[model samples]
Structure formats: structure tokens, C-alpha cells
Target: MVYSEQQIMAWASSFFWPLLRISAMFIAIPVFSGRFVDNKILVGAALMVTFFTLPLLPEHRAIDVLSHEGIMTGLQQLLIGLSVGFVLQLVFSAIIFAGQGIAYSMGLGFASMMDPTTGVSVPVVSQFYLVLATLLFLTLGGHLVLIEMLIDSFNTLPIGDIGMERSDIWSIIAWSSRIFSAGLLMALPAIVSLLMVNIAFGVVTRAAPQLNIFAVGFPITLILGTLLMWVTLTSVLGNFTNLLAESYGVIGDFLRIRR
Candidate 1:
């Protein structure tokens, strides 16, 4: 395989750009997207994977590794990667939101813990829920499927191809909002139950005029909400799993990159 300098340069160019795009996507998406993956290790790992897959990739026009278009290419890659990641982030955050609501209703709001992912204080219960959701995500192969979708993006929407259009960005914004709406629905069961408890407490206090509502209402809300959560957990998990899967599907659809 005697190759000229230009031929070698062209091969090198093709290799680096795809590698860069793949690395950017994985670096921004879930599981792989974490701060836990050190930069040195990530770069090394991505390089290895890129090289591993290089033999099988289809031909594309080689891109200049250092040029004005290359800078734009990297930025576009980063934007697409971030967009993909943010969808997953939004879905996971919805679980956190639901957890917060559940914690407040259960009187677990006072005790806070540092969330390892976000480095912020959250109700201990929310962290607990986040951990459980993380487990569920892994159990259901959410991370595996997500990473696969990312790789498929390179095929459906190749590297050095200018990334998302303006309309695509706006469409993504609309998709992101689904997380909040999904969270509200997931928490709705708990919220509605708590609201009823409050109304009951309000009515009893107003009619009797002798009850200490604050002291009594707190325990009542705490106990009843916890019981409701216990009863409704199966439904909650089912809904969450659906949301997680839907997020992957949505991201794929957005990129016009399917399995």
C-alpha cells in the first residue's frame, strides 16, 4: 500500500473529523456525558473507538483539520451533541422535579443532600429518587440505546455536514418542554391527593374553629402522601420508563437519525 503524501493527508483528514464529531456527541450525551469521565481518559477512549470503527466507515470528502470551516464544524458538532444531551437531561430532570414534589408532600423537604450530578442541595428524597432513576435507566439499557442513537447520527447525518438548522433548534425547544409537562403528569397523582388533604384540613379547621391545623395538618399530609406514593409507585415507574424511551425516540427524530 504505497500512498502519496496527499493520499495520506486525505486519509488522516477523514479520520480526525469523524472522530471529533463522535467524541463531541458522546461527551455531551448521558452516562458518557458525565463529569466522571476524565478528559484524558475520554480523549483516549474516543480515539480508540474512532480508530476501531474507522475501517468500516463510508467515504466522505476529507475535511481540513484546521481551517475556518473546521472551527464551524466543531461548533456545529458541539451544538448537535448538546442538543441531543439536553433532551436526555430534561427527561432526567423531570424525575427530579417529581421527586421534589413528592418529597415536599411527604415532609422530606427539610433534610437536604448534595446531588453528585448537579452539586446542589436537593431534598434527600430527590437524590434518593435520582439514584433509583439512574439505576432504572441502566437496567432498561437506556444508556446503551442512547449511545447507539448517537453513533447512528454520524451515519444519517454525517460529520462535516453542517448541523442543525434554525427550525430544528426551535423544534427542539418544543420537544424539551415535554419533560416539564411529563413531570407534572407524573406528579399529578401525588399533587391531587395532597390537595384534597389540604382542602379537608381547611374545611375541618374552618367549621370546628378549635383544631390546630398547622401541627395536625403536617402529619396528616406526610402520612397520607407517603401512602399514596406507595400505592401509585408502579404507575409512576411505568410512566417514567415511557418518558425515558420517548426521549430517545424524540432525539432520534429530531436528528432525522433513526436506529
Candidate 2:
């Protein structure tokens, strides 16, 4: 059977929107978006998904993709995928910031390492929390929930439409504030304990002019920090879990149509 130009355009149009969703997410997401994941792997996944989704996508068959109008449609798909990945990244970064806060309080700020996933230097304590949070995120099936939400986004906004509202962008900005808030909440237990240890050392130093408080103070804070962490570890987990859920909800609300 000979293929007409119209037939070719029909198939090509169907393919681009789905490809737009997959390709945008492939690079924007955290773990899967890492540089270590081969280009071939990402492209293969995108192609595979595009194959299945092409039939299900509503035909904006009338929308000529080569024109200025089509370019705007493409941009909208890009924004939606980027926004979804960004929300999840914020939650993980919140965990990292909390760990850094606690580490600073406990005088362990010097211990830092290059994080492979993010390609930046992070405190060892921060990285540890990040890894643990990743484990917990996977354990609680957060990744699957994120994916389901992404798929659901197609139903809400579809393709070839303006995806973001003024309020949606503000929601992202508002959620960013929680990074500092959640960080303080996670590190508060250790911060309070360390503050008391600092106060005690100041008094001891004043009382004995020759005694070096630095010699004992560091060890005391370390031990107290460890003890406080052990006592309140469950609360930390709970707080992180709540942050994760909020991240999910925020994305959902952002994708929702305004009343």
C-alpha cells in the first residue's frame, strides 16, 4: 500500500507529543535521569512508551505541528514533564538540607564528599540521609506513585494545550520554602541537644582558665548528637514521609484544573 503525505503526517503528529513527554522526563528525573544511564537506554524507554501511548492520545489531527501554534504545544508538554520531575527533586533535596543542618550543629561540616547522583559535593551526613531517603522512597513505592501521577496528567491536561496556570507556577515557589522549614524540623532534636552542650562548655571554659574546652567539647557534642538521633530517629522518618506526600499532592494540585 502506498502511503499518502496525509497518512505520514498523521503518524508523525501522533508520535511527537508522546515523545515530548518521555524525553523531557528522561532527562529531568533524578535517578533515571543520571548521566550514567546510557542514552540508548533512555531513548529505548521513550520509544517503547511512545509506541503504546500514540493510539490512546486524542487526535489534534487538525493542529499543524510545523507551524508556530504547534511549537507552543510542544513547549507545553515540556513544561508539564519538567514540573513533575522537579517536585520530586525538591523532596529529596529537603532531606539533604536537613542532614546538612544537623551536621553543622554537631561540628561535622568538614566531612563532605562528591555525590555521584547529583555531581556535587555534599556533606557525608547529608549524603547518608539522601541515600536513606532514596531507600525509603522506593520502599514506600513513591516512585510508582509519581509515575501514575505523570500518566494521569495526560488525562487532565492532554497534549497540545496550555498546561501551566499562573497559580501552578506559584505553587512550585511556595513548596520551595518548605525546604528550609523541613530542614529545621528534621535537625531540631540534635540542634537543641548540641546547644545545651555548647552552653555547658562555655561555663566550664570560664571556670577553668587553663583547661581547653575544645578538647572535650567536640567529643561531647558528637556523643550527644548520636544519642539524640537514636532517640528521635522515628520522628525524622515521619517528617520526611510527610514531605514526600506533600510533594506528590502539590504536583497533583498543580496539574488540576482551576475551579
Candidate 3:
């Protein structure tokens, strides 16, 4: 079929804008953004998703894609996708912070290994929590929900200059406070328990000055911390679910906001 210049531009815009959005999300979102996942695979997935969703998206690309206006529009689309993914990334960061706190309390802070996902060294406790959280994320269909929200976003925000506002940015900043509070709440039980254990060791040391607190207390605390983590797993999972829900809600709010 022969196509005119206008038709060619329209087709290119249709495919191009959605690809930018999808690819940006792939880069910023967890799982897909991990170092293990190949970039070519991500691009292919973005292409496939874009093709299927392109038909559903509104035709608003009347401007020249090679022009300055088109470049700005493309950037705006990328920003919107990245913002959505970044909000969710904060959720996982909160979990990692909680894990670090727990690990430190358990005297395992010095024992760290590289996390394959983020390619950083984190305490074994943090890695444990991350693994469980990732599994829960997938098992609960969180990824599916994310994709659905992304698709719905096109309807809410549309494809144009109308993207995240100043208020929305402030809202994201305000939401960041959850990283501290939520992280603390998740680790609070372990922290309190570990504090009592340390206090007991301190009293023992005071009563029996000849006993080496460093020698005896370290092993006891390490063992107790592991036990405490095992006992607290249920509560930790509950907190993670709550945090994930809140993250999804924040993403929804971001999309629902108007121009």
C-alpha cells in the first residue's frame, strides 16, 4: 500500500511515542530494570507492548516528530513513564531500608554480599527480604496491575504536554516520608526485641566484669537475630503488602491528576 508523507508521519508518531513511554518504564521499573535482563529483551518487550496498545491510544500526533515540539513531547512522555516507575522503586527501597535496620540490629551489618538485582552490596538480611518481596510482588499479580495502570494512564493523562504538575511532584516528595516511617514500622519489632537482648547482655557484663561481652554477646545476638527474623516474617510480609498497596495507590493518583 502506497502511503503519503502525512500518513507516514502519523504512523511513525503513533509507534514512536508509545515506544518511548514503554521503554522508559522498562528501564525504571523493578524486575525489568534489573541488570540480569537484557536491554534487547526489554526493547523487544516494549515494542510488542507498544504495538498492541497503539491501536487503543488516541491519535494526537499531528505535529512534526522531527521538529522541536515533537522532541519536547517525546521527553514529556518519557518523564511521565519514569515518574510512575520511580514511585514503585521507592516502595522496594523502603523494604531494603527496613532490612538494613534489622541486619544492623542483629549484628550482621558487616556481613554483606552483592545483590544481583541492583548490583550493590547489601546485608544478607536485606537480600532475604528483597527475595521474598520480589516473589510476593509477582505472586500477587503486582506486575499485571502495573501494566493495567500504565494502559489506563493513556486515557487519563493522554499523549501530550499535559503531564506531571508541580502539585504532583510535591505529592511524590511528601510520599517519600513513608520510606522512613514505613521502614521503621517494618523493623520495629526486631529492633525492640534486639534492644532488650543487648540490655540483658549489658547487665550481665556489669554483674560479671570478668566475662567478655564482645566474645559472649556477639554470638548470642547473631543467633537471636536470626530467630527473631524468622518469627517476624509474617508481620514483615503484612507490612510489605500494605506498602505495595500504597505504592499502587500513589501511581493511580499520579495518573488521575489532570492538566
Once superposed on the true structure, which residue ranges of model 2 sit more than 4 Å away at CA? 53-56, 257-259
State which candidate, 2 or 3, has the greater lDDT.
3
For model 3, residues 122-207, the per-residue Cα lDDT tens digits are 99999999999999999999988887788778878777657778888889889999988998999999999999999999899889
lDDT of each candidate versus the true structure: 0.77, 0.80, 0.87
- Whichever of 1 and 2 has more lDDT, that candidate is 2
Steric clashes per prediction: 0, 0, 0
Ranking by lDDT: 3, 2, 1
lDDT for 61 (candidate 2): 55
Residue lDDT tens for model 2, 1-259:
8998888877787788768876787667767676568889988987877787666666665456888988898888888888888877888788889888888888889989988778888888888887788788889988677766766677788776777888899879888989889988998887887888899889989999799888888898887777777777778888999998888789889778322
- In model 3, residue pairs whose N, Cα or C atoms come closer than 3 Å (at least 3 residues apart or on different chains), thus clashing, are none
Using lDDT as the measure, the top candidate is: 3
Best by TM-score: 3
TM-score of 3: 0.96
lDDT of 1 at 115: 77
The residue-level lDDT of candidate 2 at 66 comes to 86
lDDT of 2 at 12: 81
Error of 1 at 187 (Å): 0.6
Model 2 compared with the native: what TM-score? 0.91
Q: Could you tell me every candidate's TM-score relative to the true structure?
A: 0.87, 0.91, 0.96
